[model samples]
Target: MANQEKKRGIGFYLLVGVGALFVISIISRDKNTSPTTSTSAASAARPSSAPEPPKAPQIDARVTARELFEAYEKNEIAADNRFKDKLLEVSGKVDNVGKDLLDTPYVALSTGGKFDILGVQAFFDDASLPKLANLSKGQDVTVACRCDGKFGNVMLKECTLK
Candidate 1:
């Protein structure tokens, strides 16, 4: 009789624990769903427009190609956190002015001497190609561009002549 009572007590506690866990799961599930439901309802009630482009960050730091490259070479994560997605004004000697695989115009600036492999690769849109066409190798140039962080080189986008 005592063994039977003990077994019942253990089974009851196990069932209670499982029930409590089920109740907690349901409560957590409700909590997660409520925010998403409210957000969807809010979005549905609002009028939509064209998505805006990312604006250039207004920072006073005049970062050069060599400096930006060296920073990334030293510590990529720190350099990315500092320079990524920010507007930068870079001045360096032009290494190449050419089109990419998509025929998108680009300007590459040397990070070191002409023999150096690392460069700042700035991509330009179609409208900016005419301006990019005139740039020659070994020319000193200044450009304002949005830093997109480093790959093999310091990548920049939406560049404009400065």
Candidate 2:
């Protein structure tokens, strides 16, 4: 009968639809589980704007923070030749411990004068936050950092407590 034929046709299409779905799911599963595909997908999911962690350079010099500041104040060009872009270990009393305008943590070390406004400014990375949190004014400390020359103050970057 035509009615029986129509039912069989509908049932056949239903079965075919299910088979097509099963095939698609298997193909998708294989693609998702592939090593290359998964690795690339994971990398793609990471934010492009995320910055890499800062790396500390090898120490190239060691001096007191006051000595470092005086060197730059006396002659910037000579100081730059001696210390610019080089890692230095500077020791001094903490003038202040606070964040810069950009919210970067910094420790201002005294340059041997009570009312001196200029000194060595050591900027630390996020990883040094815990150590910096324990620091206080007038506390003697030593920092290892890259000498970035002077900009109002003798600047030290990528600093870590020593």
User: Whose lDDT is greatest here?
Assistant: 2
lDDT of 2 by residue, 21-97 (tens): 99999999998887796778988998678687897566898999888988998899999999999989999999899
Cα lDDT computed for each candidate against the true fold: 0.87, 0.91
- Please report the TM-score between candidate 2 and the true structure: 0.66
Off by over 4 Å in 1: 1-57
Question: Stretches of candidate 2 above 4 Å error?
Answer: 1-57
Assess candidate 1 and give its TM-score to the true structure: 0.62
Query: Model 1, range 23-61, lDDT digits (tens) per residue?
Result: 999999998777686788999999988899998567545
Clashes of 2: 0
Q: What TM-score fits each model? A: 0.62, 0.66
Model 2: lowest-lDDT 10 consecutive positions: 49-58
